[model samples]
Target: MSDSLCESVDSTNETPSKKTQLEDGSDSLSVIKKAVVVLTRLPEYKISALRPPTPQQFYSEDESHSSSDSDMEWEPEGDSGDSDFSVPDNKQKTGKPTQNDTTKTLPPQTSTNNDSVSEPAPIIISSAFAYCANEITKVRPNLPEEEVKVDMMVLARKRHMRWQRGKIVEIITREDGRLKYKVNFVEKGKSLVSGHHIAFDTTPKLEQLYVGARVVVNCQDETFRPAILAELPSRKNRLRFLVFLDDHIPVYVGLPFLHLVCRPLENVLDDVPDSPHKSFMSRYLRDWPNPHLTQYKAGYILNAELNGVQQRCEVQEVDSSLIHVVFKDNQHKEWIHRGSIRLEHMARFWELRRVQDVSD
Candidate 1:
């Protein structure tokens, strides 16, 4: 009985010791797990505390700097409070830099002076479809009816009839809901002051008029004034007029020159003389042709259209209305009517006059 009792006591003591050791081991394991978790979190906490917010974090700054102008000062005009400053959730996951993100810090901005402050809506200018294509009736003084109906058909049939290109200088709206425009015709050398409707033959592209474009200023006289397109000015109409090539001349730019500004001048010849017509003809013409062909020499140069192609030709033989000539390019002699051969001086005069008119 004594031996049995001693064994039972020893077993119970040993069991308690085993239980205490197990409990201690579990506590140590739990402590180690906690230490490992803390170590993982320490780097992230330190990095977040030390690093500054990236440019992508600020949506407003990113949007305003999209134009690459770091110094551009912009702010939400309204009082939206903290909403504008919030970073998007998707941006947090991606962490990629956007096109708008810039390194430069944005200055603190206040609200605009007025709540009404906002970007100006683009002005959509009307196209050629807006103008009236039909013929307009004009009143004549000292006439039987005091009114003349200029037929549109007759005007269309006439070759080289004046269809003056003009800009709407002023717009006036009538009580009848009809809009009238005051147009300044560059070719006509006059401004149509009253109820005249103007049309754009070719609409000017505002993007093309940006800096460093070669251009010409359309004038009423028989001279082409060349200029260079410069920085586009801030205008409500969005038309670029300010240029600095020759003397600062206000004139129309573009085909059928209308409006006041730089028009693109392509393929302008070098050393355009004081007299473009005289110089142009002097190069090809061995002898200038008189208006009446009855008084011209054999080797006269004539500007003629052969097979609908305008060319310089040398007169080989003159036979009344039929004159034999050879084209500068081709040696094959051909006969043309006297009317087909444009007189040298007359052709030059008209050519220079047209150049001044179109400013091309």
Candidate 2:
């Protein structure tokens, strides 16, 4: 029986070789039928000409100027080294050290004092010119012997906001033993600092000109129409002043937008106030100027003109040059020429007095 089973298995294997050949023949015939069907469906009509769409039809003005994500080119935002980890000079905030952070070593220490504590060199700011945070370093006139150890940021003049009278709100000591101050300005509040100085005297330089200081906004073209300094500039380099005509109307001016003339007082003693009263016009006028003249048109400022001399006017209404104004003598009249309006250089214009100078 075993022998008979073995013979049957051998016969079965020998007979199966034609089965694969039959399946291959069937697949070939199916492929041929599909090709014939596709050829019969080809269109007999001619196709229309194809052209790219016009830019005007497809794209709006804004879409053409802007780029899409797929079309944008990729580039590194900044360098991979210390630049990434470095803090801003105004407000230094360090990033955690990573493998990519550029490591920098502090400069070799020089001991300025007997104590072991490291002291950064003293930066002596020259008071020759009115200074704000960003102005370039000029030779600090008058003090040649003292070496001013300026902050690296100040030397670079990287911080450009000028705080003419910026007041220090807070002082911070950095981990690296550097000192930085937070300054605030009246015109533009809290900003970063690049340069700072310590004034020995609490009194401002402008305080000396009590009632007689005649000054103008240091405008371009010497249109230098006079504007009374309203208040001393903040510890930041900001200055606010006012323009007043005969009616004693006060128009406030802000800076660094309004550049006031800082040329040396031809006479330093001129700005000193003669009387206790703060208003410069009070000393001369028998009748106080009408305060109501201060109310101005929604867009137009009431300016005065005496001759052909014109000043920089920041008014919106420009149809006519002539505007009604009051004079120092308390006269109200309309001047034909806007250029003729004259701003007076009144001493102690705002009448601010130093605390120490006050008489009880």
Candidate 3:
């Protein structure tokens, strides 16, 4: 009986092997059928050519120009073993570590002073700028030539939505320290009047300058034109100034001759009577954008007003040459140029001030 069972097992093994071979052959046939079916389905009709999308399809006229405006690249002097980061001019929020990157590069002993119980650095910021954070050095570099090193991140305490390159701006010194500078943006090209819409207490820092005043700026066409403000070597070096104009107005000036013109003033709103009073926003008008607005362009009308017998309204508008304004009455909206409008406060014109136009 045992011998008969052994013979049965051997015979069954052959049957299983045959079954496996048959299954593999069936799979091969199935693959061949699928391939044939796919090949037969190739398009019999001619296919139309598809055109590739161009930049004009998605980007607007303004967007294309702005994308190329800042050719200057920016890189942090972060090799000091410090982690530094920058946000786009869009004024977005990020991690605190990035805000304090400038502080991280200090020597161990200097950083220790931060942890030790001591008076906080009296950071004196102007209305236009504020103290963001600090960076501190942590680990000693692992090198055969043992040397002490550190890094730090001093950020803009005052943030702006339209902040761009080449605009002469200023940041105040929070304290007396190395690698820490106030925000002072230098406008190399044409002045930007759009910044007037940006509401702020002030636009630039106005402090008495002497030896060792810091001024950080981005260099033209560098790998990383990171925000850098270093101390002015001396009063002679204090020879740079940023000028902004309101309503496309221009000023012929430079840092070397700063005192000739008005220093940036703080924007502190005066008391407004509860009932109501005349305001620029209500009457503000714009014809075309400042650039397109030429010397004598007609502008749009805004707020309207009326007196007992006389009809009067504040009209706010603008064109290339000037911000067109009109004090309308019962008759019609009368035209007034931007220059005619009295300057409210210098704060609103921080980015608008520019050097006098050499171009006719």
Candidate 4:
């Protein structure tokens, strides 16, 4: 019994010591965890304190400098309370500009005036009649009557049994409800004519005034004289033409002063009746073939068919299979098959013109 009591006491003492040691170890581990947390937090605090300034802060500094350096002594144009800060009047007396002042005083922003900038002029296309396999229909003499208005220029059949240029001066309604126009022929006097005797004045195509064609030219003396077109107008010659008058007098006339009389199919040289003027004109009449016949190249103008209708097109690019072209009439771009292009031929051109003249 004595031995059992001694052993029990010793066990109780040892258990208390072990409990104390475990409690101390737990406290030391908690302290070490707290120290680790503090060490990590210290670096974050230092980094935040050393951070660079924000953009707003830099802008505020620039604003302060601008306020001090501006020469104008006026306050900002707004409610004083709305502004974050105000410039003192004393700062304005410096009369010196800061670096920011140069930027502020820079020339006012300029905008392009689209109206003042002129648009590029449209491409002026020379007109031509395309050769058609089908026959051209004639302009019917007894066609449907058209409505006429005052001050409209028209073709009126007057004294000479030929169509003459006239202007519609007045309108007359007959008892039968038929309308007659008081046509004022510039050369002839005014007379009343029915709608059947009047037609709209149409401008002839430039192709009809080709070189070697017959036309009546208004001479310098303002007299309309018979002449043969010696040379077509070109950019080099200021768009004027060289013509031989009936008396074999050569003259340069503007396009507006010439009227097409006829386009003969035969060579112009054949009709010249062997004279010095005829020999002089032969130099201009040497049948020049279409330039593109040798090779298709960029910027060359040629007759091309688009959607089965012939139109003048400027060549943009040429390849083995397709040719890129832009239509002169509407500026429409298209890729045309090589076969669709009709290169102009001198003999064929005159033949087509003859057919058109007969149809008209």
Candidate 5:
């Protein structure tokens, strides 16, 4: 028995192993230890030795507890079993847990918070451009609406192309995309022609190809045969046009529709007098010049007949794409490279009313 537990009631202080004693239970010290344990005070939690007193029992023991009602922490005097800090408030008592942890359990997609939304729903891709077998039937215009396309090329913008056979016309496309088309003009072969460009690879619409914007799209309507550019990543073969080739002149040939800008070189032949072309021009085509080279009906050269007779008359200019030369009597006037002729030629003939001018 421990001397410290001589007056205490707890049994743990006095229980000693039997081995600690000599084999006999007759030791006087062992008897004294048991007596000391029984006399000492026991812990209050030991159910066999003691039990907790009720609040009323405690108050009965001490009158000071009943007088101070505010001394109670969780429960006040008047409000029995009521607590101010307890959970489940009126606003949060609904089926759903309104705590921050519960709100976080909902998926972000279904969140009602507008600020959490990042992007609008994606748009579904529906209609698109499609490649079709070329039709050879020539679609003639009512022939009443004949207009010229100067600044822009309608065929290049729509990614459509046109070709002609003996008596049939063909239309082709380079890519599959949405389109709105109608027959615009018809030639001898009678191909269904529209003022649309042959769309190259997947590209934006004509509305997106704004002015001053660079674009590359394949040529689908240029010919009936399979185009080589259709196999490349960008179907458009590169065509470079400068609004200003040098210090002057605005050009427009680099687009999908490549038209050779042309003007008549007919004049009084001030430089070359008594030239064959200047003397007899009517006998040749006997027609006015075509402003654009591709639209020209025929080609001619000034040649002298055997007896002082001439096939051309004294004219200003003739339509030769590589060289806009005029042989008034018999003299070379002017010429340009096929690459740089669009705006240069257009500025001189159509706009300025001057062709074969060595002065400027």
Candidate 6:
């Protein structure tokens, strides 16, 4: 049998026809038995535990050391690299970083001394106006017959429902004893209006007046014109005083028509109770918009006089003297005089809207 197995092995190596010879069932069985006998005859083999390769096998000594060091020092992005791997007590409980931890981790370090850091100081504001103009309800007083006269500058309500500045051109007596005046508007031509539809261009004077006092004069266009009292009324001109308007225009205003702007004493304001109204009044008066400094530009929203009334309008175009605007109420486009546009009113309107939104 050994001799036969040797012959069969020699035949398998010497001839490729051995595969055809092994095609028979008995021959294939003998071939398997010969393979098992060959494996058994080899030196007894023992299997040992497998071991992973060392870095030195693939890399040089310097490279292996560097790779090992990098692995030891590597960390995920945003990691502070602190030795303590344990999460903070607050973070463990909340599962989110505390405000202090966030501040420290997010912002780049700018200073070495963290102990010197301090919070910003709070801002303090002082009150200015003694009275709240917004709280007051204005009533139009009935003008005496003598006060309404020809050539007098006044504000008259037109058919379009806006009060426009105009000068009385004629006074007409009606058969019913009532009176009406023909007014020549500064820009809107002329119109006939009754006494009740007219407002006098007059401001009540303060008890004590001095030169250089800040005052607001009622202009012909039914708007307040900020001015400085330049010259006091003299014996020669007791009725009128020379004042410099915000536009640098100097004019003589009647004594009864100079409105003084009263500013509360800082000490007095401190004595008053602290309230939102007082605070708002203080801030609003301090930052009041100056019409003289108003710069008109396209897309600007402002209160403009249109067809004898003030309307919220968006500026569409601007030029040297006229501003083209589309009224917000009716979307009517009109070209208005630049002097009749009030940017301060727009600011006040936005401020009120913001306050209302917050309240809601």
lDDT scores in order: 0.33, 0.28, 0.23, 0.45, 0.24, 0.43
Error of 2 at 144 (Å): 20
Tell me the tens digit of each residue's lDDT in model 2 across 1-360.
Answer: 231122112121222222223564563222211111112222223111123455433654322221210111122233422111111122223323322112222222354434344422111111111123222121112322222232311111112211233455656778987555555543455544422222111222332322223333323342223333322332211234333322233434443323222232444223333422224344222221111011111122222334433322222221111234443333534332122214211111112223325752
Give the C-alpha lDDT of model 1.
0.33
The whole-model C-alpha lDDT of candidate 4 against the native structure comes to 0.45
lDDT string, candidate 6, 313-357, tens digits: 676765322356798789998654332323334334446557879
lDDT per residue (tens digit) for residues 234-331 in model 3: 11112233222221222222333222111111221121112221133112212110111111112222222223222223334332112334554344
TM-score of 5: 0.14
Off by over 4 Å in 1: 1-201, 218-225, 234-240, 245-360
Residue 58, model 6: Cα distance from true site in angstroms: 86
Cα error, residue 312 of model 1, in Å, equals 52
User: Please, what are the lDDT tens digits per residue for candidate 5 over residues 1-360?
Assistant: 343333454565554544345556654334334534357544444543244465445443222222211111122223222111111111222222212111111111232334343211111111101111111111121223223222222222212222222211233443774222322322332223333222222333322332222223223334421111111111111223322211111222334432211110122122123433322222111221111211111121222121233322121322222223344455644432121223222222223323324447
Residue 38 of model 1, lDDT score: 16
Q: List model 4 lDDT by residue over 222-292, tens digit each.
A: 55555566545542223556566645555666667776542222454564457544654563345211111
The model with the greatest TM-score is: 4
RMSD of 2: 29.7
Q: For each candidate, what TM-score against the reference? A: 0.17, 0.18, 0.16, 0.25, 0.14, 0.22
What is the C-alpha local distance difference test score of candidate 6? Answer: 0.43
Ranking by lDDT: 4, 6, 1, 2, 5, 3
- Residue range with the least summed lDDT across 10 consecutive positions in model 5: 228-237
Q: Report the candidate with higher lDDT, 3 versus 5.
A: 5
lDDT for residue 46 in candidate 3, whole number 0-100: 20
Q: After superposition, how far is residue 178 of candidate 4 from its true place, in Å?
A: 36
